[model samples]
Target: MRALRAGTRTLDLNRRIAVMAIVNRTPDSFYDRGATYALDAAVAAGTAAFDAGADLVDVGGVKFAPGPPVPVEEECARVIPVVEALAPHGLVSVDTFHPEVAVAAMAAGAAVINDTTGLHDPRMADVVAAGNAALVIAHSLAAPRTQHPLPHYDDVVADVLAFLRDRVALATAHGVPEDRIIVDPGHDLNKNTRQTLELTRRLGEFQELDLPLLVALSNKDFIGETLDRERGDRLPGSLAAAAWCVAHGARLVRVHNVRETVDAMRMIEAIEGWREPVYELHNTRPEGND
Candidate 1:
């Protein structure tokens, strides 16, 4: 797969996993509600994420869990300022399925559109294509504000792979290049605990698509349920899940705790045999001494 370049940083799929920090600019995000709602707070969060070694920052306006919906105009208003604030820093991704928000975010200099609804909105592909930005196609079986009650799959891995393949084809048919697409299984979106766990365990199956896979299991409800902890206490479980995902072929991890995730990624890379390349060899002795 070709590397997707966002400003000075190029995300090589063959290299170690890339970390995408989550910066929710909404007032009701499940994890970080109101943490980054203000423009100044959002900027500070973005800077802190970058300083902590995030390869990208995902900014979201509308919280997509089981909650009341915000109008598209309102969502656009909430996301655009953060996108503008983070533009010059590189690799800012807007997390929304609304076409208007996606367009506005791109206009504000976001490099990627992370649509958790998997392009269910007809105008989404066009907006993303118009901006020539990367798109994260995350699979959710239901609408943006609802959860999938009693979700079932004949074979979760195969179904996810097929769904993502079709979504990629749809985007490509709409003029979005294949290289600019990434796939996510939509970890907690519309999925029950068992389904989410199974998807995480079988993440490697989706690699057959050959596009960059982004696993976003950070601080989600499933982790909390499994670990028997609150949202704030699920950091260790989140890090563990991220490491497992990276080992299983995920190229990018969307995380809430940027610093901890960065440290965990470094540890995973070291265990996976990552080593610095030797670029120079010094010779102290004279050239003809031997």
Candidate 2:
């Protein structure tokens, strides 16, 4: 995968997995349950997460599930401050389908625009290209913040691959540079546990697109139901899934637990030899020692 740049910060994602910490600013978000709804709280959480070793902080002002519609101004008001505050710390990606909100966030120092709708909106790619920001095109069943119940896919993996290929081409046609684009197989977004699992099992298929593949499987229903664990107790499952994705082909992981994900991924990298060990003392034979 090519390197991804978000504003002044860039992620050299070669033979390495990058972690993005999720910062939800909505009061009714599924996870966190409004813990960081307040501006100060959100900023603090993002800052702390970055310090904990997150490569980027994905700031989302509205809940992903169906809820009250948030105005563009409201969304901007919710996330811009956090993005500006976290700019110097590391890369900041704004999760929004609204072109207006994406533009505003980029103006405030965001480097990546993670539109969960997969560029369903015609204007989103234009905004990303115009801003010269990176775009994360995620595959969603339909428009984000809407309902698509009882979803059906003939072949979940095949469908996801085709959708991503078409969308990535569309983004390039819209003038969004190829290197600045990323693809995500939206887990549990209008998909049931079975479909999500199948997608995960064949996750490497997404590498066919030849772009960075990002998966947001942290504490989602698929993992929880599969393991019969609650959200608070799903870290182990989440980490396992993340490690599996990295081993398979996925290059980026989005999650809430920044510190744990960082340590787990570092260990995976160390074991795989994709990253150098910090101390290099384990199981090493010193020169002339034997």
Candidate 3:
């Protein structure tokens, strides 16, 4: 696995999975609504997430829930302030697809751009390249703020892999280095329950891409449906999915419950060390020699 550089900090993938705490700056985000919509609340949430062992905090504007589109200026206004406030403490990732928002957030000291649009916006790549910021090219089949109907895939894993591969290639061709890129499968972005499960089950397939993989499976609707829980009650399922992702070679996990997820990951890491066979051969000889 390649070393993922978020600003001056570099995460060695073989060591452990990086935990990214979600800090929603919008009022209507599916999870953590109103948790940090205001500047003061945003700062407090960021501090708590960092204290809870988050390697990065992803701040987002323009809630992506099914609704009318928010103007680009409003989106920028909502997120840039939070980014600016949290810039000094740790790595901050701006989750926005608009090129203008990307530019503004970077100016506010965000080190990464977590674009759900997969760099579909022509100018988004250029903005990221110009800022020398790390880019997360996430797979999503439809635009934000609209209901994504159930989409079909002949092979869900293969299709997701190909889509992410193509997006990474496009970004690289536009001057973004491979080291500065991360790919996400975009869980629940445009998938049905089965498709989401298949993607999660086969996440290891993306390891062949030779880039760090990020799984955003925090409180998504698919988890809610699978476990028969409301959106707020999906923490256990989310933690389980996160552990599964880590075992399958995921390098980054974007989640809402920072402290709990961090604890779960630590426990998983400890258990992971035990998975290797511990017995060693004492003085042994070939059968014929013996």
lDDT of 1 by residue, 100-185 (tens): 88878877888889999999986899878877679999988888788778888998888888889899989988888777889999
Pick the winner on TM-score between candidates 2 and 3.
2
**Off by more than 4 A, model 1:** 5-9, 275-290
After superposition on all C-alphas, the RMSD of every candidate to the true structure, in Å, is: 4.7, 2.2, 6.5
Local error of candidate 2 at 256, Å? 0.7
Model 2 earns a TM-score of 0.95
| Maximum-TM-score candidate | 2
Q: Is candidate 1 or candidate 3 better by lDDT?
A: 3
lDDT computed for candidate 3: 0.86
Q: By the lDDT metric, which is better: model 2 or model 3?
A: 2
Q: How many backbone clashes does candidate 3 have?
A: 0
Which ten contiguous residues of candidate 2 have the minimum total lDDT?
Answer: 281-290
Q: What is the lDDT of every predicted structure here?
A: 0.85, 0.88, 0.86
Q: What TM value does model 3 have?
A: 0.91
Tens-digit lDDT track of model 2 for 17-85:
889999999898787899999999999999998899888899999877876689999999999999888
Q: Summarize candidate 3's per-residue lDDT along 1-290 as a digit string, tens digits.
A: 88887776777877777899888888887777677888889889998999899989999887655788889999988888888888899999999889999998888889899998788786788888888679999998877667778698999999988998899888988888898999999898888888999999988999999999999999998899999999889999999999998889898999999999988877777677833334535445454432
